[model samples]
Target: MSKVDVQLADVSISPVQYQAQLLAALQMRDLDKFTQLLDHCRVDAFSSVLESACREADCAQFVQQLLQHGADPNILNPVLLQTPLHITAELGCYETLQVLLCDDKINVDALDWLGNTALHYAAQNKDQDTVLALLEHGSYIGSRNHAGDMPVSDIEPETLEKFLNTRLKMPNDESLLFKYDFLVPPVALDSALLKNKLSDEKDNVIKKLSSPSPEMDPIVQISLSSKQQHLLLHPIISSFVHLKWQHVQKFYYYNLAFYVFFVLLVTFIILHHHITAIDEHRKSCWLNLSAVCFFKIIMITLLAICCFCLIFKLLFQVCISPVQYLHKWSTYPQLVLTLLTINVLFIDSGTGDSAVTVITLFLAWTRLLLLTGEHPAISICFHMFQKISCTFLKHLAWYSLLIIAFSLSFYALFHDSKAYIAEKNVSSKLFHNPLISFFTTVSMFVGGFETKFLPFETASGTSHIIFIMFMFFLTLVLLNMFTGLAVSHVQNVQSKSELVRLTAEVNAVFDIEKLVLGNPVCIHMWMRRLNLSHNAVIVGIFKSFVYLWLSFSWLQCFRNIHHSVLLFPDSSFDYANIVYPFGNSVNVTWNYRLDHKVLLQAANIVQKKNDEARQQLDCWAVFESYEERLNNIEASQLRCEALQQEILQLLRLR
Candidate 1:
C-alpha cells in the first residue's frame, strides 16, 4: 500500500476508535474518563457516540457534563436515532437524569429521534414517578414528537385516567384543563347494522352466563333472580344500627332476672353462715329463726324470678340473627353490674359478723365474670404472663398472679370470718402464710353458687378436701360448657358464610321466566324496602303474627315495669328448626332453613328479571355513545362555520 493510502485508512478508522473508547469508558461506569473524552470531542461530531452510550447505559451525568462543556443539549445522534437524555430516561437512570435536569441551559422539552420527548419515554416505560418529575420540570406534555404521538399517548390510558381522577379529586389540584380534557370522548357513530351486532353480543353474554359451575347446584343456579344483593348485610344492620325497643326491653328484663339470681345466691350463702352460727350459739335465738325464714323466702322468690326471666329471654332470642346476638350480648355486663349492686346493698349490714359478711361478699365476687365482656379482668392475668421468660414460666406466673390477687381480695374483706375459719383464717394466713391463703382463695373462687352442705364422715380435714374437690368440678363443668358453645357458634358462622358464597354464585348463573303478574324488579325492590327476608310466612299466619305482637308488647311492658325480671330460655339446637335471633320469626336454626327454601325460589325469579334489566342497561350505554358522537360531529361543524365567518369579516376589514 502507498503512504497516502495508509493515512486515509487511519483517518477512516479514527471516528470508529473514538466511538469504541467512549463506549468502553461508559461500560466501565468511570465518570472521570467520560468527562475527559467529552471535553476533547466536538459537540456535533460526538453526538452520535454520546447518544449511543446513553442508550446502552445510564449516561445522564456524562450528557450533562458534555452539555455544560458546550456539547449541544438538543443535538440528536443520527446513527442511533436518540438524544442523550431521552435514552437515559428510558433506561430508568432516574437520579442521573435528575442531575442533568438541574441544568437550565439544557432544553428539558427536547424530543428524541423517535419523535418522543423525555416525558414520552418515561410514560412508555410506565415510570409514573419519572413522568411526574418531567412534568414538574416544565416538559411539554401536549407536544407531538417526530411520530406525531403526544406525551399523554405514551401513558397507559387506564393508569393515566386513574391518576388524573385522583388528582382531580384532591382539594389542592384544581385544574380546569384536566376536567375538560377527560369529558368522556364520544364513540364513533354506528348504523342500524351495528345495533344488530350488539344483539349478537347480548346472545353471547347469555350463553356465557348459562353454563353453571359443577361445584354449584344446577337447580338452584337456574332459579336465582339477578337483583338479589347479599342478605348478609341484614346481620350487620342488626349488630350495629338496629338497636330497637326490643333490645331495650330484653336488657331491662335481663337486669331484673340477674338481680333476683344475685339475691337468692346471697341468701343461700347467708343461710349456711347462719346455720353455722346457730350451731356455735354465736347468734341470739330470736335473730336465728327470723334470718333463716327471710333467707328461705329470698331464695324462693329469687328462683322464681330467675326462671321467669330465663323463659322470657329464651322467647325473645329464639328467632334472632347473629348480628342482634352481638347487640344483646353487649348489655350483659351492665345487667350483671346492676345485680351485683343489689346484693351489696342488702348484704352490707354493719351489724353483721365477719362470717355472715364474708360469705355474702364472696358470693358477690363470683359476679366478676360478668365483668369479662365490659372490662378485661382476664386480660390482667394474661399481661403478667408476657413478662415471664419462658412459655411454661409465663403460664406459671399467670396462675400465681391470679391466685395472689384472689387471696388478697378475699383476705381484705373476709379476714374476720369465724366459720371453718380454719386455724389459718384470712388475717393470720395473709400475714404469715400466703401459700395457704392462695389455695383457700382458689377453692372459694372455683366453688360456684352450689354450696349445699354434704355430710362427710364428720372428719374436718376430710370434709374440707371433699368441698374443695366439689368446687373444682363445678367450675370446670361450667367453663367447659361455655367453651363448647363458643366452638359450636364459630363453626355455624363458617358454614353460613360458605352457604352464602354458594348462593351468590348460583344467583349469578340463574335463568329468567316471564311472569304475567308484574315487574320482578319492583317486587324484589319492594321486598328489600320492606326488609322482609324471613318475616313473610310468619306474618301471614294469625298465631305467628300474634306471637310477634306479644313479643313486642311484652318488651314494652318490661320497659314500663320497674321491677320485672327477664329470663332467657334455652333454644333448640336442631338446624332444621333453628331460629335466627333478630326480628320477628327469625331464628338462626329456623330462619336459615326457611331462607334456604323460600329465598332460593324467590331469588331465582329475581335473578332472571335482573339479568333482563342489566341487558337493557347495556343497550342504553351503547345508545348513549351514539348520541354523544352525533353531538360532537354537530359541534365540530358549527365551530368550522364560525371560523369561516371570522375569516370573511377579517377580509372585509382589510
Candidate 2:
C-alpha cells in the first residue's frame, strides 16, 4: 500500500482490526511494521496489542521496541487486570519478562483478576528464571493471592525445596543501584576499635575546644556542630519515625528499667509520708528523720529529671504537629504528670495533700501499666476490659436515668408518710436524701437493698405496686440487657484480638517514642559515662557496705526474737568449675574474665551497628525530602499548564 493508502487504511479500520495487525507484526518480528503500526495506534490499542505479544514465544524484541516507544509496561488486560509483566510470567516468556522487569515503572508484584501477583503465576508454573527475576526486583513472597495462597505454596515439592535452598544475591546492576540505595548494608566495624575510636574522637574534640583556639578552622567548627546535632537528634529519628525493630527493643529495655525505678521511688515516698503522719515518735527520731530527708531528696531529684525530660518531649511533639500531639492518648498522661509535678513542687505538702493529689499519684502509677500493652497477652486483656467497660457504662447511664426518675417520685410520695417516718433507721433514711436516693436506687439493681429496706414496705398499696414494677424493669430487665450487651462486646473484642493488640502495641511504641526518644539528653549516654567513671567504683563499695550492715543488723534482730525461721536451698552449683551435660567443665575463675570481655565486645558491636543504621536512615530521609519536592513541582507544572490552556480558550472566545 502507498503511504496515503496506509494512513487512510489505518483510520478506516476498527479497533480489533488495528490490534490484530499490530499483534501480527509483533509476532512476525517485523520491527519496521511494528513501529509503523504503533505510530498510527492510540495508547489503549497499543497496550492491548503489546500484552498479546508478551503471551507469544520469542517476542522479546517486539516487547522491547514497544517499551522503548513509551508504551506503558503496567497496562492491564481488560478482563484479567493482568499487566504485560503478569502475562509474560504466566506464559514462561523469560526474555520478554527480563525486558519488562528492567522497567522501573513496572510493578513486579502486580496482581491480576484473581488477585495473583506475577510471582504467583511464575511459581504456579514453576518458572525458575521468572521467579528469580521477580524476587530480584523486590517482589514479596509472602503476599496471599485471591485463593489465599502464597507464591511459595503454589510450587511443586522439588521446586519448593530448591527455592528454600536458594540464597537471594544482592542486585549489583549499576542501573538498579539507585533503586536499592536505601537497602545498602551498613559497614561493619570491630567493636572494640569502634568504641575506642569514638571515645578518642570525643575527648580530642573536648580538649581542643576547652580553651579559645584562634587556629581552629571555620570548616572544622561547622563539622563539629553538625556531628553534635546528629548525635542529639539520632535517637528521636530512629525510635519515632523509622522505628527500627532492634533499636526499639533496646530503648524498650532501657526505658523499662528507668520507669520501674521511678514508680518504686514514688511509691516509697508516698508510704513514708503517710507513715510519718501517723507516727510522731518515729518522725522525731534522728534516723527516721534522716532517712526521710534522704528519700525526699532522691524522689525530688528523680521527679525533676522526669519533668525535664517530659518538657523536651512536649516541645518536640508540639513542634512536629500540635493537632496530632493532642490527639495521642499518651500525651494527656504526660501533660497531667507534668502539671501535677510542678504543682507539687510549688505547693506545701500540708496544703496540697488532697484527694486530687492522691488521684494523680494513682494515675501516674497506672500509666506505667500502659507500657505493658506492648506484650500481646496484656494488650488483648486491655482491649477486652476497655470494650466491656465502655459498653457497660453506656447502658448504665440510661438505666440510671430511668431509675432516678422513679426514685424521685417514690421519695416525693413517701417523704411525709407516717409509716416511712416511723421506720427511720440509718439505712431507711438514706432514701430521703436526693443524692443518696439515686445511689440507693442504683444499688438496688445489683440486689444491694434488703426486702425490709424497700421503699414499698412503708408506702401506700398503689405506691407499693408501682415500686414492684419499677424494680422488675430496672433490676431484672435492664440489668440483664446490660449484661448481654457487655458479653456481646467482649466477644467482638476477642474476635479482633490480634488487630486490637497490634493497634495497642503501635500506640505504645509511639508513646515510648515521644517519652523516651524525644528527650533532649540521652540517658544512656550519661549511663555509659557513669559506668566508666572512678566515682562508680566508690559508689559500688559504699553500696556493698550498706547492704552488709543491713544484713548483719537484720540477723541480730532475728537472734533477739524468740521465733525465727530461715530456709536454705538443698542444691547449688559450684562456682569454681561449671559442668555441662557433655561432662565438659571450664574453670570459672579463668572463663569468667574471658566470657565477660566477649559479652562486652558483642554489646559494643550491636551498639555500633545501631548507630550506623540511624545515620544511614537520616541520610535517606534527606533524599526523600528532595524527591517529594520534585514530585510537587511536577504536579504544579501540570496544573499550571491546564490553567493556561483554559485561559487561552477564554481569550480566543472573546
Candidate 3:
C-alpha cells in the first residue's frame, strides 16, 4: 500500500518498514526515533510524513530534525495541494510554524490549490504568533486569492484593532482603512486579469445570495468605500508618496503664486473702482486710469486661467476616486466660483455686479486653503475642520425644526409690536419679515439672549410664555449639545494626529499624481536610454497643460507617462533603475536586511486583519444549510395535510 494509506496512529505491516517506523515516531512525538528515521526516509510528493509532523504542537523539534536531514519543508500534499506550513497555520501549530520559517529556503508565501497563501489560513486561526511569524517573513498582505478575497478582508477591523497595539508607542496604520486600489493608478484596469467575467450561473447564484437592497451591491459598496480615505502610516508606502510629492510640488506651487498675484490685483481693482465711483473728484481724474485698466485686464486673464486649471484638475481627480471627488463639499463651491468668474465680463457696474464679485472673491480665498493642503500640517488642520463641520451639521439638521418654529412664532407675535418698536427705535427690520426673523432667531442662539424683547407688547400671557420657553431651550439645551459635539471631535483629532497627518500626505501625493502623470499608456515608462524617455516626458508635460486650455478639462493628446515611478519597488517595473534620497545610508530594504525585517512586520500586521472575513463566510454557509433543511421539512408537512384532507372527503362520501 502507498504511504498515503497509513493511518495517523495505526501503522500497518508493510514492506517499506521505515514509513511505518516514521509514522509511529511522529504519533508518539519521539525526537530520537524521528531523526534516525529521517536519514533512511526521503522527501516525496506523495508522502504525508512532513504534513503529519506539523499537526502536533510538540512535534516542532521533530519537524526541524526532518528538515535538517532531507525532507522538504515546502512539500505539498497531493490531495490538499497545501504545504506543511499551511497545515501548521490551519492547525495553529505556532511552534511548528516557527521551525518551518527558520529554513532560509522555505517558501513562506506558498500558495495552495485555492491560490491562498499560508498567511490566509493563519488569519483564520486564533494563534497570534503563527500570524505574526508569517507576516515578518514577508507574505504579501495585498495578495488576493482566486475568489477575490484579500487576506486582510477576512479579519474585521474592530476585532483586529483590539490586539494590534494597546500599550506600546507603536503607531496605528489607518491607511489600511482603504483598499489597495485607492493609491494604485488605472494601470491595473488595463491588465487582462481583471477583464475576465464570472459565468452567468455563478452571477445568478451571487445575486440570489446577496441582499435585495441596492446599497449592499458590490458596485455600490465599492463606490461608497472610495469616499473613505486612509492614513498611510506604513514606511514603504510613505516613502513612495514622498517621492511623488516632490514631482508634483512645482506645478502646485506655480498655481499658488499666480493665484496670490491675481487676488492682490483683484483687491486693488475692487478698492480703486469703489473709490472712483463714490468720489466726484477722482471719477474725472485720469491719474493712472490706463494702468488700472491694464491691471484689470491682467487680473481677468489670470482668473480665467486659474478657473480652467482647477476645472481640469478636478476632472482628473474624479477619474482617480470618482465618488470621493464629487461628495467633497469644496467641489460645489469650486464649481460655483468658476461660473461666477465667467459672468464677470458681461456684468454691469451696479449692486448686483458687486454682490457677484464679492461672492467670487470669497470663494477664491477659500481655495487658497485647499491649495495649501499639500503640506502635512495644513492637511491635518483642514481635515480636522472638515470632520468637525460634518459632525456639527448633522446635529444642526435635527435642531433646525425647533429654530424654524420659534422664528415663525416671533414673526407672528411681534408683527405689530407698535409701542415697543416706536419706543426702542430699532430701525434694523429685525423681525418684521421671514428671512430677517429666521436669521435674528439664529443670532439670538449664538450671541445669548437678545435684550430687544424687553418692551415687546403681547396679545396675551401665552406669547410671553412662548418667548420665555424659547430663550430657555436655546440657551440651556441645544447650545451645550453643539459645544459637546465639537469638543469630542477635537479630542479625537488630537489623539490620531499622527495618523491623520499621514493620511493628508497620501492625499497630497495622489493629487499631484493625477495632475502630473494623468494616466499610464500602453508602453512601459522605464527608460533604457535617457534621451528616448526624456523627450516623451517633455511632450507629456506640454500636452497636460494644453489639455486644460483646449477643452477646459484633462484631454490628453499624447500617451500617458509612467505611473510605475510613483509606485516604486512594489510596482512591476525593475527596482535597479531607481535611486532615492536615503539619508546617511542607514539600510536598504531590497539590498540589505532592513527591508526584509520590515516586510515581515508588515506581513504580520496584515495577517491579523484578514482573520475574521473567512470566519463570517463560514457562518453564512451554516445559515443557508439550516434554511434548506427547514424548506424540506415544510414540504413533507404539506403533503401529509393533503392526504388527511382526502381521507376526510372519502369518509364524507361513504
Candidate 4:
C-alpha cells in the first residue's frame, strides 16, 4: 500500500513510512536499521516516531535503540522542545525508561523542555519503577519540575517497592536516594543542598547518617554517664556554691578590704577611748598589740580564701577534662565549709582567751605558707648559710669600727690631761653606763659602729657632759636600727611560717597516682620533702639552726631564703662551708674533717652514678628490644671501665 516499500540489502524491509516505519521496525525488534534511522533522523522528525512506539506499546525497545544511536533523551522536540523519555514516563510507560537507561549514554540527570527530568514525569504518572530507573542512573532525586512537584517524594510506598524490585536488576549507584532509605522530602532536599556537599562515598554516607544521632558516639555516651554521676554525687545547691568559689579570689579581696577597714577603725576607736583612761606606756603597748592582732586576722582570712580557691579550681579543671564524677569532698562547697568550721572552732576572742582564735591564726599562717609556696626549713637555712660570708664581713667591719672608736674616745679623754685617771673615768663610763654600752654594742654589731669613732669629749672639761650628749645621739641611731631589724625579722618570720603551712598542705595533696599523671602543684612538694611534722608544729628546725649560725657569722648580708642553697651561677668557690665559720672551726678539731671528706667522696660517687644513669636513659630511647638493651648496657659499662682504668694509669704515672 505504501508503493511496496523497498527492502534493504540486510534483508530487512522498511515496514512503514515516517513514524509508522520506525514503530514497525521497533515492533519487529529489528535493532539494526532501527539504530541507523535513529541516527539519521533529527529530534524534530522523531517526535511522532516516539508517539507511534508508545501506541504500539513497544516503546521500551524503541527508546533503548534511540539512545544507542546517540539520540538525546533530554533533547526537546523542534516544535515542543520536549524529550520523548519524559513524555513516555508521564504516560506511565515504565518499561521504556528501564530500556532507555540500560544504554548508559542518555543523561538520566538531564531535564526535559518543561524543565522536568524522567523522574519528574514518572511522579506525575505515579509510576515508581520509572522513577527508580532514573534514580539508579544518578538522577537528581527529589528535584522539582516546572510544575514544582517533587516526584521522588510523591512516589507512593507500593510504587517505591516496585521501583526497588526493578532496582535490584541494576548496578548500585552512589546517589543520595541509594544511600539514605527515606525519600528526601522537598524541604529537606533544599536544606541539605545548602549545608553539605553530598559525595558519592561510603564513609561520607556513614558520617552524614551519624550527624543527627550523637548518642551513638562512645565518648559522648561516657560524658553523659559522668554527668549523671556528677549529679548523684553533688547536690544542686552545692554545685552553685562551688561555682561561687570560681570567683572567690575577687570576693576574697573585696571582703578583706572591707574587713580590714572595719576592724582597724573599730580597734582605733577602742584604743583612743582606752588610752585616755590608761597610763601612756601601757596605752601605747596595748594599742600596738590590738592593731597587730586585728591585722593578722584579716591577712590570714584572705590567705585561706586564696588557697581554697586555687585547690578547688585545679581539681575541677582536671576532673572536667576526663569527664570524671566530681566528688563533693573535692568541691568548693565542702572546702569552704571545712575552712569556715576550722576558723570558728580555732579562732581566739579579742582578749586572746579563745582556743578557736589560736587555731584559726595557725590555719591562716598555713594558708599564707601555701600562698607563698616557699619552704621554711629549706629557704631559711639556705638564706642563713648563704649570707655567712657577708654577715662575717659586716661583723668584722663593725668590730674594727668599735676598736677604732674605743681607742679614739680614750685618746680624747686623756690626750691633753695631766693624769690617765681622767681618761680611765671617761673610758669606764663607755663600758659601765647602760645607755652608752647598749648603744655602742648595738652599733658594733651592725656596720653602723663607725660613728662611735668620733671624738666628742676632751681632757680639759668634765667628760660627763660630752659623754651624755654622745650617748644621747648614739641611743637615737641604735633605736632606729633595732626598729628596722625587728620589722624585717617579723616579715621574714611571717613568710617562713606561711611556707611551712603550705608545705604541709602540699604533702596532704601529694598522691603518687596523681603525680604520675601530672606534677604536684599549688603545694610545695619539694619543701614538704624537707620538713618534719611533729606534735602541733611542723618545724623546719634545721633551717632555724642554720639561720642562727649565719646570723653570728659574716654571712648575714644575703637575705633570700628559698633560693639560698641552690648552686650559684658561677659556683667557682664553695660557700656551704663558709657560712658557719665558728661551728666548722670547732668541728675541724674533731673527726668532722673526715666526715667532710667522706661526704665529698659520696657526692662524687653520686655524680658518677648519675652520669651512668643518664647514659642508660639515652641508650634506652634508641634501642627497642631487650637484647639490644643488654648489649648497649654492656658496651657502655666496658667503655666506662676502660676509661676509668686509663685515668687510674695516668694518675699512677703522675
Best by TM-score: 3
Give the whole-model CA lDDT for all candidates, comma-separated: 0.43, 0.55, 0.56, 0.42
Q: Rank the candidates by TM-score, best first.
A: 3, 2, 4, 1
Query: In candidate 1, residue 208 scores what lDDT?
Result: 23
lDDT assessment of candidate 3: 0.56
Q: What would the per-residue lDDT of candidate 3 be over residues 1-654, giving only the tens digit for each residue? A: 333333333234343566677888788877787766564444542145777788887888888877766567778777666899888889888888888899988876566656567878877665556666675565544444555454554443433333232211212332112122222322122122111222334243222222111101111122123222221334344434444555455656776787676566555545555666555544334454676656665766775676677667667666544555678777788778767756653353322458887886787777776767657767767777888888878888988999999988878876655323556565444677887778878888788545556335565676778778887898788888778888888888888776666566556555454444442221111111121234766655643433333343243332223332243313322331232222334243333322333334444555544455567777888988999999989998999999999999999999
What's the alpha carbon RMSD for model 3?
Answer: 20.3
Model 2 poorest ten-residue lDDT run: 563-572
What ranges in model 2 sit over 4 Å off? 1-30, 33-63, 66-100, 103-136, 139-247, 268-289, 320-323, 348-350, 414-428, 449-451, 455-458, 491-654
Q: What TM-score would candidate 4 get against the native?
A: 0.23
After the best TM-score superposition of candidate 2, give how far the Cα of residue 401 lies from its true spot, in angstroms. Answer: 2.8
RMSD of 4: 37.5
Model 4, residue 576: C-alpha shift (Å): 75
Question: What tens-digit string does per-residue lDDT give for candidate 1 at 529-572?
Answer: 22222455542463233234334534443332221110111111
Q: Highest lDDT: which candidate?
A: 3
Pick the winner on lDDT between candidates 1 and 4: 1
Better of 1 and 3 by lDDT: 3
**Which model, 2 or 3, shows the larger lDDT?**
3
Question: What tens-digit string does per-residue lDDT give for candidate 4 at 1-654?
Answer: 121132232334332344465666777878776766665554444545654464445557666565554455555556544566666677776677566566655555455434466677776666666766666565654445444444545555455444333321112121101121112111111222112222344243323222111101111111134222121111111111222222122334453454344334333433433444445644365357677546655654654565455455456445322223244233344344345433442442133344444444444444433323323234444343334445455655765564455445644564443322343354324433434554554564454755444344443354555555445544555446545655666566456553333232222222211222122111111112222234223333533432342344342233232121121212112221111112222232112222233223333434554577789987886665777888999999999999999999999999
